[model samples]
Target: MTFVIDRYPCEESPRLGAMILLPTAESVPRARRWFRKFIAPYNPACSVGDCTLMISELVTNAILYGRADEGWCVRVEWFREGTSLRVDVHNPGFPANVRLRRPDADDAHGRGLLLVDAIAESWHSGPSAFGGTVVSFVVADAWPA
Candidate 1:
C-alpha cells in the first residue's frame, strides 16, 4: 500500500527525516539504528537512548498489529519542533486499538505503549489523514540550551 508522510505546517516544525520499513520482526532493531543515525548530529541535546527505545516499541507494534500481511509497510518520521522533537509511526491498523494496558507480571508482552507513556512528554494515537493509524510522541526540551 502507498502511504504518504504527513508534514506539519512550516510554522510548527521542519521534518528531520523519514524512513519506510518492512513490517517484520527485524524492523525493530533497524528502526533503532535508523533513529540513532538520524539524530546523531543533534546529540547531547536529543535523548537518543530514550528515543530509540520508544521507536523500537512503536515499530514493533506496527509490525505485529498494523500490517495485515507482508504487502503492507510501516513509515516512521521525525520532526524538530522548537525545543522538542516529535516522532510518528504510521501503519495500516485501527487507531482505536492502540492503547496502554496493564500487563501482568508473567506476561512477556504488552508493555510497549506503557514504556512510551512513562517516558514521552506527550503522546497520542489517531487516524491518519492519508489512511490508517498514526501514533505520535513528543520529547520536550529535546534541544537543551
Candidate 2:
C-alpha cells in the first residue's frame, strides 16, 4: 500500500470542521464510524478511502503510544478546505519519534507513519495545544470539486 504524495499549495479554506474525543483504544472504531457518517454528505469528490485509512492509522498510533492509565484521550478532528481534508489526531503524550524504517518482512509492526507519509499530501507532528502531541495530515483529494 504505497503511493506518491502530491505537494501543492492550496487557497485559504474555511474553518468548517468537527472534533471527537475518544477516551480509550476501544473507541477508535467509533471515531471512524463517526467520520464515515460525517462525510456522507459530500459528493464522491472526497476520498473517503484515504481518509478512513489515515484516521485508523493515526488513532491507532495515538492509542498504542500513549499512557492509557493516565486517561489519555485521543482527540480526532477534521476540517474541509476547498477540495481538501485535514485530519488530526491529538494524544496526551509527546509525539512519537516518527521515521521511515525498512522493517523486515517478519516484523509485524512499525509501518504506520510510512503508510501515512506515502498517502497523505502533507503531514506533520508537534506539541499539542492541550499539552501533548498532535499529528496532522492533509488529503487534498478528499474534498468536493
Candidate 3:
C-alpha cells in the first residue's frame, strides 16, 4: 500500500526543520543537502546541523549492521515539536547487536551512538512497523553562543 506523508502547512509548523523518507545509501548525502534546505530559512538558533550528523551516523550504522542479502531500504525523517527537533532514520534491518558501549582509546570505530548521544538531548533506536528499525534523536533548538 502507498503511504502519504502529510506536508505540514508552513504556518502550522513555521518553526520546523527536517528531511523525510529518504530511500538509499546514496540518499544519505542527499539527506545532508536536504537538511541544509530544511534549516536554511529558519532562525540560525533552530538549526539541525547536528541532526544531520546523527543522520549520517545512524544511516551508516544501518548500512553496516542491518543490510541483508534480501531487498532493503532506508529513510530519514525530521520535524520540530516545540523547541526540540526530532530526527528519525529508518532502515530495513533487524540489527545484529543493539548494545551501547563507551568508545575505547584504541578503537577505530563502533562509536556511532556515542557521537549521537553526545550531540542530541536524547536519542534511541527502535524497530519499525514496516519491517526494519528507526534511530531517533531529539535536540534542543538552542543555537551555539
All candidates' TM-scores? 0.87, 0.78, 0.74
* Model 2 residue 138 distance off true place after TM-score fit, in angstroms: 0.8
* Per-residue lDDT over 1-145 for candidate 3, one digit per residue giving the tens place of the 0 to 100 score: 2122334448577335434433456766766777667566555574456766887888777667665577665666667677666777777777446556786899999888988888889988778656677778888764443
- Per-residue lDDT of 83 in model 3: 64
TM-score of 1: 0.87
| Regions more than 4 Å wrong, model 1 | 1-13, 68-70
**Ordering by TM-score:** 1, 2, 3
lDDT of 2 at 3: 13
The 10-residue segment with the lowest total lDDT in model 1: 1-10
In candidate 2, stretches whose alpha carbon ends up further than 4 angstroms from where it belongs are 1-16
Against the reference, the lDDT scores of all candidates come to 0.83, 0.70, 0.67
Model 3 CA lDDT for position 30: 68
User: Which regions of candidate 3 fall more than 4 Å away from where they truly are?
Assistant: 1-9, 13-25, 142-145
Clashing pairs in 1: none
Best by lDDT: 1
Better of 1 and 3 by lDDT: 1
Candidate order, lDDT descending = 1, 2, 3
Candidate 1: residue 21 Cα off by (Å): 0.3
Error of 3 at 142 (Å): 5.3
Candidate 1 local lDDT, 1-145, one digit each (tens): 3333343444444787787888878788888887787677655375789999999999999888884533778899998877889999999999999988999999999999999999999899999764789999999988864
Better model by TM-score: candidate 2 vs candidate 3: 2
How large is the C-alpha RMSD of every model relative to the true structure? 3.7, 7.9, 4.4
